[model samples]
Target chain A: MTGTELKNVKVLAANIRIDILKMLEKRGYGHLGGSLSIADLMAVLYGKQLRYDAKNPDWDERDMIVLSKGHAGPGWYCALANCGFFDKEWLYTLNEGGTRLPSHPDRTKTPGVDMTTGSLGQGTSTACGMAQGLKLKGSEQYVYLIVGDGELNEGQCWEAFQYIAAKKLNNCIVIIDDNKKQLDGYTKDILNPFSYEEKMKAFGFDTQVVPGNDVEAIDEAINRAKAVKDSAVCIILDNIKGSGVKYAEELMANHSVKFNTEEMVNKNHAAIAELEAFVKGAE
Target chain B: MFTLDHERKMGKRELRITVADAVNELMDADKSVLFLESDLAGASGSGKIQKAHPEQYIQVGIAEANMMGMAAGLSAVGFKPYTHTFGPFATRRVFDQVFLSGAYAHNTINIFGSDPGFTVGPNGGTHTTWEDVALMRTIPGAVVCDAADDVQLTWIVKEFAKSEGIHYVRANRKAVRNVYAEGSTFEMGKGNIVKEGKDVLVIAAGQLVSDALDCAEKLEAEGISVEVVDMFCIKPLDKELIIKEAAGKKAVVTFENHSVIGGLGSAVAETLLEAGVSVKFKRHGVEDRFGQVGTADFLQKEFKLTSADLENTIKGVLL
Candidate 1:
């Protein structure tokens, strides 16, 4: 990607991070770490890669996104809102009673969320089914399945992965966010998924690893994945648990954090201000 | 319109074959109608459909939870996905997925769980599921039904083709006694009164429906008038029919192939109590026990699920 194109996506990523922080902070507590980690990828999807219309979210010809690691719904919702799928003000009502933006991605409730997911590995199978449906219908549309590294602990993910690889469902691109940390601790300390690239390769996927928070790299990786024809494709994003939020990245309990303390509230405000400035400068 | 076959002969078509034929007809009619099996094509009798309509059939291979989510995914993309597996796996094993992906997500999926209750035969306790109806009833907007014959099972599959949301229809794989006649049509959420009487009302579902009718016939020979109503649709149960049937009856007896704790008995009990239609009520079935390895007949007797058990319950209730 060119410098200008990369900058554009980075700007998109910054805005997504800002919105996520604002929403979570407004709600006082939520899944902060996971949402922040996927901002760059979400930006790459909403900014350059995904073929969707803001006016018609359910357009048949558009490419779909299934946020399998649905706790990161703030990031997905922010990206969709930035792309005009819904009002940006709706982000403030995240997880509130009777709100459109739920704590997890719900296809029926959210505009751009193509698959309802929060129960970890179930979305992998759903994405495979969506891909198979597209193939059966002879549609060229693609489904981007966003999965968390920690979410792979679910056996259903492996079941879905095997099916996808065996069926050669190239239309569904599997993107695993290898943020290393889960709800409890580091994934290695917990389940120890060893090497995702090796595992995906053994599972018959044409695998690629890229920095999670890098806009240009993620964009290029997705482009490569889209070009593959014969085998299923998987991209592993190797990056921090809280990619853009330094305070959360350094904090041990960053997964579902409460900004109850004065320090936490201040830190969140400062982080959002910095990202907002970056977006403003890019614009 | 809710009459019985009365002859009580077993339907010529096995329920598995009936389900397969209905699914095949659905596939032939609509390109969007798809069938998914979890390595149970032969068990579900959909292997032929799988062979003929490979594009429309998905063999997910032993992943019941994944199959449910996959069907939800297919549903999201406007495909009417019909998923088949054993009763336990379909409801008990994949309850969360069915609740979240299928029902909570508002996706349309028709789940056909074969070999429910005692129908599992020697597949044993692990394969047997007596809580499917109870589990399915808890889900919001889920349509739960139990098939007593091929006619009812066939109508349910075809009816669900145009119906939206989560639907679960449990039936036996082998041929059972015909509760409804051939070419019989059914109204969803309405109970079928097989026999009318004022002495006692026997509300039953699945394999127990035929037995309940036989028990009613036996009681009639002994100068006792008994009513047998097929409470097939357990979720949006035929409350009107149940309330109406329970009125002026001497006693109410619920017989089912499931545990008496939550299946047809619980549903009927709740309906009767809530409607204030007080009567001598008895929930006659497995009393909070796990299924054991045995033939259907042996297990039925062991669980006291035969017509004789219904006769005892009816007599006990009348007294």
Candidate 2:
């Protein structure tokens, strides 16, 4: 919460947003929507909150983070690269064959990934297990799991939530990226999660709803969660699918935008340029 | 040759007690060893282990899927988690969790699928898991073994402690003949040749090993000269031993307290086919059928997984 640390987080967040745009632009088409939505949250976590060392990513005492909504891995990969877990040049290898940066984060391949997660609700259960294990071993390291709001439609998520609360795993933190969109359309049109906070509170979690794009707010909530002594914390992040770039944010299906022509690629570059200019101006 | 009193004086310990006692000893020795039960501790005869090691025992309600995932997580952070549940739930209900979390993810979690096959008895078809062995064997990189008796159970627990990755140990709740000696050595992927012969080979695992041994004895009296091999490890099968036995013998009869499709019989068949050994083979087990309610003895008889049935199958195959 220091002024200098606050500035670092904002800079990291802006850089992460730029990285997501560049990766998507390189891939020609990818999950720009949901991935961009989580950039600020990832910045807050990787920059100031989560206890991790990029140099020793496998440090046994490091805090664990599970990206349950693994399609948003570009956002996580960007943060990891920015944090020096691996070279930022490796970002272009996203979704490429023979590359360690897979579409879904593989724990063995990625330095900072704690669990290999892609099958939706299962990762939360894994996070719960890690948290419980740490508590059993009397380790102070925490586990942070991020699940897409639409991904909460899976019954297994609820099952994991109940177990986390039942075990009273105060060391575990769950963040639901409420971008409100999924593969088909909006979550409410698909399967509504109703109220993320109320549902999590019912399952015995200390619930918080915060503006997902605000790094300061995200960091404050995470600090509050760290201070909580008894209950597991659930943060419902209210975020837009494509939060930074103008063209991508305006598109309807930014989840996996198809940039077929040279014109589309140029447009994406222009939008990224605008974001870069705005970031530099703020600094 | 032995009278009823002489048989009673043999003083062999029951298999269920042996398994429970071994688990209890292990829990007492290792604090990192945890036992998660799905409300079957009393039936599995491991209530003592749970009672003595309450700190290490977790009763995860009756949710088998959740329990499997939880055990995987525990294994990820260095706890040796042993989840005990009935065979049906342990194999069928939570198979994905076992496949992905335990095997594919390479977690060293041991699953005790107790009361395998018709060993559940009057607990009936609903509880009997004749296909559990087949189901577990289908998972890649899974070490599936069914302990023949109390001695094998002790060896299996010890072996599993030294080994890594996922292991599914099928436990028969009913008491069976004690085949191995008190201090007999057991290997995970090596089969024990109980009775050596030249005419035919009898391959079996779990409770059916005793039936094959009895059949081998019966066949010996009739001058059939049968060899009985205890194929304990079903997955990563000892293909070299199987091929050697198959090449030496004219025919092979496989027995298991499971379905003939994908259990010990199929494992032997697959190995023989791959080795290009043209030995005649027959299987004695549940012939792709579900089980019914009865006593363990009665169900074994009903399912045709008995000494007489195995003997007939062996004789027919050899002839």
Would you list the clashing residue pairs of candidate 2?
A: none
Error of 2 at A250 (Å): 3.9
What DockQ do you compute for every candidate structure? 0.86, 0.59
Q: Give the TM-score of candidate 1.
A: 0.98
- Misplaced by over 4 Å in model 2 are B1-19
Give the per-residue lDDT digits (tens) of candidate 1, residues A1-283: 7788788889988988888888888889999899999999988988899899989988989999888998988888999999999999999999889999999988888887888899888899889889989988899999999999999999999999999999999999999999999999999999999999999999999999999988888988999999999999999999898898899899987899998999999998899888888888888
Q: State the DockQ, from 0 to 1, for candidate 1.
A: 0.86
TM-score of each: 0.98, 0.93
Worst 10 residues of 2 chain B by lDDT: B1-10
> What's the TM-score of chain B for every model shown?
0.98, 0.94
Clashing pairs in model 1?
none
Q: List model 2 lDDT by residue over B143-178, tens digit each.
A: 999887767777887677677778888877666666
